[model samples]
Target: MTLSNSRFLFSAAGLALASLLPEQAAIAQSAAPATITVQVNKPGGAIPKNMYGLFFEDINFAADGGLYPELVKNKSFETDDHLIGWKAVKGAAGLESYIVSSDRPISATNNHFLRLSAKAGGADAGFVNEGFRGMGVKQNAEYTFSVYARRGPGSVSGMTVTLEETRRPGPGPETPPSGQALAQAQITGLTNEWKKYTVVLKPSATAARARLKLTLDGAGTADIDVVSLFPKDTWMNRENGLRPDIVQLLKDMKPGFLRFPGGCIVEGITLDNRYQWKETIGDVAARKPIINRWNKEFKHRYTPDYYQSFGLGFFEYFQLSEDIGAEPLPILNVGMACQFNSAELAPISAAKGPNAAGQGDEPTLETFIQDALDLIEFANGPATSTWGAKRVAMGHPAPFNLKMIGIGNEQWGPQYLERYEPFSKAVKAKYPNIQLVSSVGPSPDGDLFDKATFKMRELKAEFIDEHYYAKPEWFRQNASRYDKYPRSGPKIFAGEYAAQSVAIASPDNKNSWDCAISEAAFMTGLERNSDVVGMASYAPMLAHVDAWQWTPNMIWFDNLNVYGTVNYYVQLLFSQNKGTSMLPVQLPGNAKNGADNLFTSAVTDAPTGDVIVKLVNYSTTPRAVKVNLAGAKKVGKTGRALVMACDDLSVQNSIQEPKKLAPKEGQFAVSGSTVNYTLAPNSFTVLRIPAKK
Candidate 1:
């Protein structure tokens, strides 16, 4: 949308918004607060015109990760076995090995286990564990740590877990300045068996955040589990606690849809252990937690064991999507499972009912049918479906009423293909109304997608979720990430996309601050071919940069704050401002830096007789765009614009400091049928001309 350089005159809408501005003055402070101009005119000799639009991804309110809670100040109780205070092993059955406080402190996280190895010289007290062993401390907040020990004898008092600030004896005056008694907790135990202890170290002083070491000086020989620290905003958060800043990112992007509980987080090793809809719903303390394969650093061991308190379950996902004005696209377990091997999977057949844990063998082939039934319940189940009933029990009686359900995520390798066909066929037969999406990708070393696309179409998948993680320049030059492509049946859902550096890890997509800008430029190509591409969404959407499992992604946020990397603005510009229909446009100049070059497309608001033109300048140097609006003369009057851009290519916007690249009004003069203006480099400028009428 274009306006003059003068102060914005209040329209009725503006006046209404102004009345509410008092409550949001702080929010205004949070926007980019800077301005860039946009110019528009009729296309004549040097002018180029075509329609502009954006492809949308329903990434569950555009939220992919982070444990969000339902209410604020509502601490979700969880136990990390790291703090081994005191416990009683009633017998071999109830408190085998040893029993720590699972009642008060919470029974979750890797830091809440006990270690004993006195009699048998093996772990005799505590839960069973696997992976590395050792005792080392002196870490930051929320660390992962392990311990070793032999079972202690007697009832409630022989041994204890202690932490000291002193350096060793005879260390030449190497004692710490201050001594803080971490824990003098007792280890009253029995048996001559080896036992391992693990827990999250709760620190007291700032120095403790730095000097944390694991030691087993208690009365027992012990084995140890790995120790590590949790990244900030450790697990699922609650409402009021759901980082408002992150919420704003989705609102600003104006996504048309969203998908949730996703990306590897789904299709866990087992059904009981999967991203269960039940565990991820209401009340954080009530949800059972699990481990994150992506181990964190500070956490000696990286197990996110907190009850999901699934406050943001299906209902919340739908609510957030609706609140942010985006459609919901959810992905459910297809039954193949993440772990290829059966032994590696968690036992769940016992948890639900008869075959709940799949006591017999791998889940029956018929197991795939359950998801189809679930899809119906989630989308149309009138508070009666088994799943819908569950949602209601959680509080919201109404189903999420969602229709878009995908089959799987990046299931490309042989494992994916071998397991996909069954789910696809089953889902199609049961619910033909819901749109189905599949994963497809560009050929990187481990990421081979072309073959998967072929298989998807062969299997008659409705839409292959196409993926492309290329360099910024590639996004611009290769507008047709999949143009003129021939698919037997499925349309395209640009599911997972970001500029990735295959040869090396990128800090940002292609390490380009202009990644989003170039993405916008390339979107023109996708919009032009929307006839074949039905939908799309960006992947690995949210990251704590600190807990970043992957890089070059779309959005990055922290516990209290969130920010938009350079790429986010480009997404905001296109998605927020797009045309209902696409118009053909061409760039005769052949701008340099493929991704940073100028790309064009146009659309006319026929009713108002106003024409809109979109120009993407993907260059480091500014270029003058000549508007030859010879055809727009009849409807042309004054021209205005809404531009989206940034000052520096690498400039980013965070909750504390946001940088807006949105288009502002620019000055333009109409000379009969021609107009001209110089556009900045690495920017997406959108211009709208007023009608002569």
Candidate 2:
């Protein structure tokens, strides 16, 4: 076995692998004084069962009216869990059932359900349930329904809850479309109390595209709470049931891992006001939402739905990661507070002042510890475990086996640093099995660690979160920034990398070209160092035009329509072509006069004898380059190549126009240790070759 001595000069599309060692004919017949050896081998040991992990950021379930099964397409009028104290009122607006979650099991701070009534849409009269949008239910698909509700006083003898679909300005009854209907009875009964109920509805052939609707008709009111619906194929949660076009965009982008909850969610609030995991779970109504710290950025008094009903809670996150085939890496609230604390800081003192109401005083350390335990229990806890039992009750009994748990989104400063250490140690001590991730950077909330690897190591952090929101070209050039990272121990996770932010980033500011080129370049670095980079996940994975807090999200949607921005393709290109066993190949240096016009790197699966070279051309004009395989002892006469390139970098794909950025592959010439071809500007390309004899 022999190794190669090589010094490389890379410019435009040229690859000059100048051997630095004496030539060895035994290994390969090379012409240059710089000797090279490419040792190729067959497929070796088994590869990991999982190659990639992907999924959307979902909190929509908890945001939905509740996790209780929305009685869409059910046989009878049924209520969930909350079956008491709800009274029916005939108002000018119509027959509205007050849904209050204040009953025994429906109290806040955990166990809570809605109190409401159920009846049938008696031809002329009906109940209109608001939308529980999420996980792609916005699109037409097969759905299952369930709920936990009970009948109240004076129930309808033969009441039914019919499923109907209508637009926001919805049409009237009779002429109204029937999505699916379910009717149940035993009405006109029960005293002040709470009972459980369940119903299943099958879609008629008439069922088409529409959101879930649970209509109670034929008179009588029943207290209700907790409802949920299941769709065969949809987004993990409602928040990002973003359109398929956008999802497919992400699938195409080979990001190593997703860092989320924020590019800003890290701005930790005071102790009581932190992202309480308990509040984030089950039933949107029961889960009081919170204001987004970035709310001020929108230039409007907008509240962020961050106080998510975690119905799509920790377990759901894991499910989403599993569904999308992306690893789950979510942030948990670590004690230290990181928010805008100025003159107002005194009021919200840890235990004194007005802010003290929420975080002036931190939670009892015991509560913090319990929350951490609950988080883990939800991830890998057995079905019978406390939180795990709830998960089983929620439907998905199996554990998500969460591998990465991030503590504190963004908590910096000496105070936070002091606090973070304990949280870090606590998390590590408790969940020795899972990898603990730390945030570094001034996110909207605060706790951003340091750039120096030593500082990161000083904290004993397993991983550091690196975020970037800049022009596309910045992404391109900055992608290589990690190459020179001289650190061991704590790996890097590109948790929130994006080209644009709504208020923080401008779409018009950065041309689509910059987005494409920069992101491509950035990703190349992440892939090159996948060994050191455990994973990468895009931030603002989605944006609702009406609900957008950030611009240039990986996926964006408006109601029924959706689109993938120009930057999305960068992720798609790498995700689709990612190879294991990252071969260490030195790219040729910069172009003539040191112009960094092109970037190149190669990875080979020594076992499979397969070689992959990724060429990123960031120029406006097309450039030709050659991949030098001279040092690669083995060389084949011919091989295949897959390229994902577009004519223009600024050209984006919209709902009205998809396929604008998809990849189209073609075979190029591969002769000797060199494979040569033209690379379009602002484009990403991947080439694969076989090991020679």
Candidate 3:
């Protein structure tokens, strides 16, 4: 009773659905139908609790504008261009100028502040903040507007903040407000010393592209910094929190772990710009901004204004992992910049000297090692510990229960090996039980990647991180990629992977149905090899519709709303149905996986006492599959199925039509120990049947 793109026409004879086409009839007459057997009683191995998870990186506006929920882009005026998101709005008679100044600012770290000088006070004599693709405000929804301000040699005794609709002017000129205010709030007190101010404004009408205008109350000068306009409604209703909708999408997956901070963002363009976990931990305002590594990385989608404000920093990452009930798997910079970038690397030790010539003020490998140790302390140490004390001060007294840490993000060769040896040793020496995930470079399979994997095995690493970004066909063809991997060596962590509809990193890449179904086919191998493949997650978890620099993302969102792509549903079905123990699956003809364009894996959920089977039909024809749950006692008469299918492979989901390619749930009857189900064409289906050993 599962609804999908492909269907069967019942015949009076009940022998076949309908008269098959010439080729199909020939095939049906020549051979028997495909049969899959799930050995329910013979569970192969215990599936790791954290097998399927999310890999989060700050690319494609995934953090600042997308998930962090801070509508104001350059809230702190600390970007290389201080006025990146701010512009002056001159009145007919007042408003002299606006400049970013640093004299006696709010703090040394947050040095830059916007100083506005005006000859007179008026509604138009203010500066407007062009939010992240314009603010997304809802009707009657309260927004918390806050700023740090002080008097600056003027009669400006107060500030007027207005949330107004933005008018789209022609190019070159600054975008101006439409003069109609959606919400308004006023701050009356102005002190000589820098202090934070807060006010809440409720919009009378919803405006997706609204702007925030802050004007002077009197003719004078005033300084303002850290201006933020955040929605009052957030995940858990905590201040400086994440967008509830996006976080809800993540939580729904029931992910095992949340790998954070980055893919390449951990390895910056230069050693100096590398992501420093310590810097991302303390006061949100004090955390300085750095140019995002993805900015201008692709010439086709050049985003010059992309910067990391660290508002959604390490503390928030750990907190978010906890909120989503996922183990925090933090990846740290391994004393090296991105191999694709400048390839700057830090020395193994100060005594050993710089690895490469012309390296500038790079912290030694010991610094990176110490950072890893301190991160453990920050995550799991006692309150009396220095780093744990800082965590407690941030309202999280209990440890985040962090387990494993990734050393490098896609690094390879002798450089990675030499540095990783000491790094892993140091971490193990301090915290012997802590597992480490070492890198095997960016490519899924290559001479260098294989060499790196060999080296990691030699080093006796806990996990070898493998990454792959390839075509849809590659994923379907490589359904058994891990079948030949040895079962006794270091475990495998498929750290990052996605099926590209187009070329890898291409601007035209899409989150198409074909890619999603193909990934599901490939993931069956990972599930089958759970004894060796411990963890896996899709890459670049999120992207903004208007501000994205990358494609093929799992989730897409705008300033106002969010939606999961077709690939997201595929991932959701797998993660949510990942059973407790692996069940052996036998395919018809003793053929290899992906044989005849059909792929499958099975598992048993001990808690629910259900036999779970996942099947993928990559062909354009309906497939009647008979699943024999062998050695089962008390098989329920009915079972549930979650299916996602599309006749067109190119179909995708958008913000307006979020569920255009979503999963459908239905129930099917089971005859004794056998379940017969017809999989729709180009579909990924999961069956949960109640049973007992």
Considering every candidate listed, which one attains the maximal TM-score? 3
What's the true lDDT of residue 231 in model 3? Answer: 90
* Alpha-carbon lDDT of model 2: 0.49
Please rank every candidate by lDDT, starting with the best: 3, 2, 1
lDDT, candidate 2, residue 64?
28
Global lDDT scores for all candidate models: 0.48, 0.49, 0.87
Between prediction 1 and prediction 3, the one with superior TM-score is 3
Write down the TM-score of every candidate. Answer: 0.63, 0.72, 0.95
TM-score of 1: 0.63
Q: What tens digits encode model 1's per-residue C-alpha lDDT throughout 537-614?
A: 666576654445456656765433456665666666566555444444444443322332557656555455555667
Q: After the best TM-score superposition of candidate 1, give how far the Cα of residue 67 lies from its true spot, in angstroms.
A: 6.6
Best lDDT among the predictions, by candidate number = 3
